[model samples]
Target: MLQVQGVFKSYATPQGPLAVLQGVDLHLEHGSSLALMGESGSGKSTLLHLMAGLDQVDRGTISIAGQRLDQMNEARLANWRRTDIGLVFQQFNLISSLKIDDNLAFQARLAGRFDPLWQAQLIERLGLGDLLKRYPEQLSGGQQQRVAVGRALASKPGLLLADEPTGNLDEATSDEVLQLLLDLLRDSATSLLMVTHSTRVAERLAHKVVLQNGRVADAGER
Candidate 1:
């Protein structure tokens, strides 16, 4: 469902042109999950940003669900992100002013894909039914992340992108969140591309890709 070919990306730093990705080739099949592993500054997140159309690719092609992301204008990219992609960040980017219920339904409503039944189901499955009236600050780190996951899936997005999704949680909490995420994605048949440093977390996915020095060092399917 996602494809990248011969991708090269760089940033203009005061020192010089800092290249982060070089001739990177990656692919994810429909309804398949892939974990991206890399050390700091290895271009893993940069690749993700390119796929999300949040950053311009210096060279190469990125296609998602047969749509060419590199060619899309900003407006089209924004719409595609809202309609086709579900993103979960390490920071749990929730609206502080909105309550839990509003936060979970926010993106879905914006995408015009809101389904009350589906959202309610998500809330229950994520163990968030009782916290709907609470705000982000009122919940623990794990609870906030659960709400983030529910929010991401409420829209029934074709692809889900998670960046260090469990980074802020403890080991046990991280495992719990990861399992919950995988279970939901499997049932929903949404493709996943996650960036993580933990081998245990990466092993839970169907496929794995490791990046090094701005290139794909290794990739394999379990």
Candidate 2:
């Protein structure tokens, strides 16, 4: 459902242009999950950002569910992001003022894919049924991350892009969140491309791809 071919990206620095991703090629089939593993500055997050169309590539192509992301303008990319992708960040980017229920339903409402039944189910499944009236500041890190996952899935998006989804939680809590996320993905055709530093966490996915110095160094079943 997602494909990246020969993607090259770089950024400007004092010295010169610093390459972040060089000829990175990867693919994930429908409903399949893949872990993107790499050390700091290995370009894992850069690749994910390219896939999400948050940044432009210097060269090559990125296609998600047959849509040419490289060809889209800013407005079109924003629309695609809203309609076709569900993103989870390490910071649990929830609105400080919005209550849990509104935060969970925010993206779905914007994407015009809101379903009360599905939203309710997600809240219950993520163990947020009772916390719906609470604000982000009122919850723990794990609870906040659960709400983030719920918000992402609430849109019922075709593909999920997560950047260290469990980064801020404790190990045990991270495991819990990952399991709940996997269970939720199993119920739909949504594919996952998650960037993680933990090999153990990467092993939980069906496939793994290691990035080294902006290139895809290894890709194999996990």
Off by over 4 Å in 1: none
User: How well is each residue in 1-222 modelled by candidate 2, as lDDT tens digits?
Assistant: 999999999999999999999899999999999999999999998898989999988899889989899778999999889989999999999999999999999999999999999998998899998899999999999999999999999888999999999999999999999999999999967999999999889999999999999998899895
49-134: candidate 1 lDDT, tens digit per residue: 98889998889999999999977889999999999999999999999999999999999999999999999889888999889999
CA RMSD of all predictions? 0.6, 0.7
* Pairs that clash in candidate 2: none
**Per-model TM-score versus the true fold:** 0.99, 0.99
Error of 2 at 90 (Å): 0.7
**Count of backbone clashes for each model?**
0, 0
Window of ten residues with lowest summed lDDT in model 1 = 116-125
